[model samples]
Target: MTNISGALVSLALVIGIGIWGYKLLVRDVSGIPVVRAASGEMRVRPEEPGGELARHQGLSVNAVAAEGVAAKPADRLILAPKPLDLTEDDHVTPAAMVATAQQDQAAPAPVDQTEIAEALETGNVEELVAQLTAGVAPIAETEAEVEKVVATVAETVAAEVSAAERQVAALLDAPGVRHSVRPRIRPAIPAEVTQAALTAETPQSVEVDPASLPAGTRLAQLGAFDSPEVARQQWDQLMTRFDAYLADKKRIVQEARSGGRTFYRLRAMGFEDIADARRFCSALVAENQDCIPVVTR
Candidate 1:
């Protein structure tokens, strides 16, 4: 009997605790409550927390609201409007603006075309040349004009050249100017004979025996004359003319066989010095005009 009574008390305690917990979990709070409407219906008034219902007033809730939903005011701040009269005086009229643009678009004043054409056609070259020379402007521009200027210069030059040429020609053509004509004489030996002779240490003076003291040195044999008698006659004529001064002179006769003829030669003998001999020879040369200096070994 006592064990049955303990079991009945424990079951009553468990049932009372479960009922209190169910009431506490479903309770409303103290705030504005959220409302949920049906699919195509609108909410008239949202329920308040703590089971208090509020009137709808004029709020327009959209028909698509979910269960227990409500609308609230936005959190953004609003800006104030600016006054329009502050900038009212800065506007321009449309007509006045169009007239100002037209003035800017108009073409500039035209240049004088005739003056420009004249300036381009007659450039400043003549004016520049005139300024450089400090002279009057030139008017002519023809080939004849240029040729006339050239001819004037040429005439002046020709006059001076002709005067100089006449003076030179007169000097060249003067009379009685005894110009000497030296004959071309070839040595018996080769052309290098003179060079060899200069280096040969051979005596420059003629060789003679003292017995022929005033009887000149034998230079060279001149070869045979035309005839021995004719040669003797020529020598006697020379002796007759200068024998007084040539008394102590010597002569040289060279004989060679040419065409099988024998010839004799006679020349003036005895000159004390070569200068004396040359002077005598030169005098003879002036008179007879045929003698020359002879070289011999």
Candidate 2:
């Protein structure tokens, strides 16, 4: 048992010496150091309890110090900015308000209905010029604008005038309204009057010879007979009596056969000197109801 105790004591002394050597090697001597993360941030770790050397050296310490200084500057800049402050008195003043009210009251009212209608109908440039001279503010901004409006109005008026003139001219030139006049003169005498004068100058007498007329002229047969002997016998009896009536103005000029029958005709005295044969034939027709008078050529 005494030998086992001596061995355990020696083992304990060796483990204690080994632990002291490790603490002497790892303990920080100068200062606790900082380290940089992969994202370029600085961070601190606790120093080893019994170390001899520092872990973070010059480059790592300088980088952490720069990050801390940059963070401090950003915070100071954030704290330095301030919002602007304004009071109610910094807005509009009483004098400016009064001036604006006065300007609103001084402005002209809208144009009357009668004036607007007259302006459209007349399109008078002289009236517009008068308005400008009277200091109507809105319309008379510049000479160019006024002239442009006047030119537009004048063009409309000119077109209307031209259209009316064309309508009037067309009406005057219409076919029914326009007429052509021609003169007619009458002659001293007409052709019909000359014809009448010539007819009056001619002779009115007509000469007829009874012997040249047809044999049946004096005794016209009333109807047809079946036999020529019957017709001739009837004609002879009528002529024998007719001869006595005609003896005072005429004589028997000839006897002829016509239409398969015989007839005797009497020739009158001169009708050129006196119209006795026509008068006798007229008398014979008047006296004998069955007789008809026929004048020969």
Candidate 3:
């Protein structure tokens, strides 16, 4: 707190000194007008007119003409009008007769009132309307030619589509890109040679019969399966996976039943006894295999 107060005091003193130096040494550069001592003739900034003039003449503006007069109430209220043009404007037959007086200077005798009413109200206004509209010529049907032109355009479009379809069909039905080219077929190998080559690549596995083992031979069961075929397939897969350990062992799919569930046991036969089966199963178990040693009764 003491250091802060000391620093603030020092800052205030520096600012005060700077302001004193500016006032004492520097001429006033602020926009406020300063009268110089050298100008001896100019006294006070030339005195402005004391108060506002007797009549203020402000900036000129575009104003409306002063000749327009206010309208009187009687003049503003619309009159009933001459009442003569009303009859002329309300009905058109009389006005059209008067307007076409030159054309009617020779024709149009006075029509009978009863005859006109009967002719006009005879279930349709056709005769009266026809008499009224006799002079006004109707606009002619110019669109017929336009419709004929549109029909011609549609026929042209259809013809173009058929031509395009024929062109595409011709392109598709043209001869093959490699028509004259012939393919060379490789000769087939003889069945005997194929068999020999296959035999050389993959030697045939020996099939073992469970009955051929000695009397006291024991079997190591790999797993119990639902069918003999599944057991055989499992044996093949296990032999493939553990070829080094189970290669010499013989596969046997033995069917078994407990109560109702009849299953086949995939067993490795050709073991001399339980001791050999146990050793074989121990080796498989060491490699994370499931094995059970069983004595074939």
**Who wins the lDDT comparison?**
3
Best candidate according to TM-score: 3
- Sorted by lDDT (best first), the order is 3, 1, 2
Compose the digit string of candidate 1's lDDT tens values, residues 1-297.
788888888877788788877666666433448797668646555565466655664343531153122334446668889866646568753331232232123333444566556656889556444434443324464466567656776776788789999998887798766476886777656665444434423222222342443333533222348665665555555556655544555555544465787665444445444565566665555454355444333
TM-score each candidate. Answer: 0.23, 0.17, 0.30
Q: Candidate 3: which pairs clash?
A: none
What candidate 3 gets wrong by more than 4 Å, as runs, is 1-205, 211-215
How far does residue 46 in candidate 3 sit from its true spot (Å)? 99
lDDT of 2 by residue, 107-208 (tens): 345456787668878987577556544545464555775576667767767887899999989988887846567555565455574444343222222224
Misplaced by over 4 Å in model 1 are 1-224, 257-263
Count backbone clashes in candidate 1.
10
Candidate 3, residues 1-297, lDDT tens digits: the string is 999999999999999999998886655555477686774665565455575464533212211123122222343446686755557547654221232233222334456688778886775577766665565544453366456656776776788789999998887789777345665665555445544333222223465666665565688889998987887777767776687877677677767799898988788877766888888887677557899998866
What is the C-alpha local distance difference test score of candidate 1?
A: 0.53
Better of 1 and 2 by lDDT: 1
Kindly indicate the candidate among 1 and 3 with the higher TM-score: 3
